[model samples]
Target: MEFEVQVRGRTARRWIMFGMIALGAMFLAIGLVLTGVTASFLSDAKRARGSVVALEWRDDDHGASGKTLEHDTPVAYPVVEFTSADGMPRKFRSSAGSNPPSYQKGDLVEVLYRADSPEDAQVNGFASLWLLPLIFGGVGLGLSGAGTAVAMVRRWRS
Candidate 1:
């Protein structure tokens, strides 16, 4: 009471898929390690009334200002400079971002630090988001390996 699949086409394709799986897994592992290192070294350093040293850009003023949440308008966000709990000066910013920060210059903001290393930190609260990509990469790697292994075994028996 079992269903047997009769694979067709090129048998060599199985080995190719197996190779791809191994390669994907390798990339996945590397990505995981990188994200882990980053998460370990630095995190969202939540600071109390953390002072904003500068504003890099202005998102959306809508011609409205004064304690109002930033809107769709384009503004400048200043690069905020602050001292870590360890008394080390740090520059907080959005990654790969050319635009400005949403907050105003000299604005106080919150921060957080990596679980392993508090010296390094990020301005955004979602620093832990780094794990998402890492997790996805790991899954992709594992799936690829599994697929390859299954195919190889099937081909071997065939």
Candidate 2:
């Protein structure tokens, strides 16, 4: 009976350790992806004058009836049109959106893009360019740190 209890305890410890490692890996992966994306965006980034073609809304629907629907602050992605360094006309939808709609049709804005692939672009601004990577990287670092702390504590205790 005592031996069985000991085996069970060991199994539980292994499972817990595995869980911590898996969680840490997941966070690290997220951090790496965000860092890579940010790096890619910054590489060969070119700026151009563009105009917002329209404010598009992504709507969210609420509970059971579906008749009672709620809109998620009416955020809109700016559809920007610009000419690339190679003089190719390109239009892209900025991934960044905001509540109360940040832009309107025909609004002039700065656009940042890669010369090689102008279709891959973003509206030139701090939020559009940097917010996601910063937030994701910060959270990932926090989670990874916590996981490492847990592992170290376990090793010390053992």
Candidate 3:
């Protein structure tokens, strides 16, 4: 009975280790794919100077009870207006936002857009282009390293 219990415990540990490694690999793959996509976009994108025309507000609460708090503030995403390569005016809201607001109305910022789809412009900044990939990749490396360390320790103990 004791031997059976020990075997079961080992099996569970193995499964846990495997799960961590698998999840880490998945995150790493997603990060790599996102990095590639960002690189591709940057390669063919056109740069333009845009002005922050307005701020679009979004609720920060993730579907919690609709109680309003004085300290709670809505995230403000900047809406930028710029002219495309062909001299046509275009507007797009940035994907990233902050609590206190990152940009004010009339603030000029760099914009990147594809000539074919000028309306699908994005703010040209590190946060807009590489933040997600870096986060995912870092998490992936941490998790994977932890799992590998666990496996090594288990083997050393045996």
The candidate scoring highest on lDDT is 3
Q: What is the lDDT of residue 81 in candidate 2?
A: 89
In candidate 3, position 106 carries an lDDT of 94
TM-score of 1: 0.46
* Clash total of candidate 1: 30
Better of 1 and 3 by lDDT: 3
Clashes of each: 30, 0, 0
* lDDT tens per residue, model 1, 42-141: 4443452356675555444344445545445455544656666667677765332223435666666666555346445555444234655666687777
Question: Given candidate 3, what's the lDDT at residue 109?
Answer: 100
TM-score per candidate, chains pooled: 0.46, 0.71, 0.90
- The regions of model 3 sitting more than 4 angstroms off are 61-72
Instruction: Please estimate how well model 2 matches the true structure, expressed as its whole-model Cα lDDT.
Output: 0.78
Off by over 4 Å in 2: 1-10, 60-74, 104-106
Candidates arranged by lDDT, highest first: 3, 2, 1
Per-residue CA lDDT of model 2 for 4-115, tens digit only, reads 9999997897677667666766766776787788777777699899999877776543557655455435567778889989988888888888776688889999988887
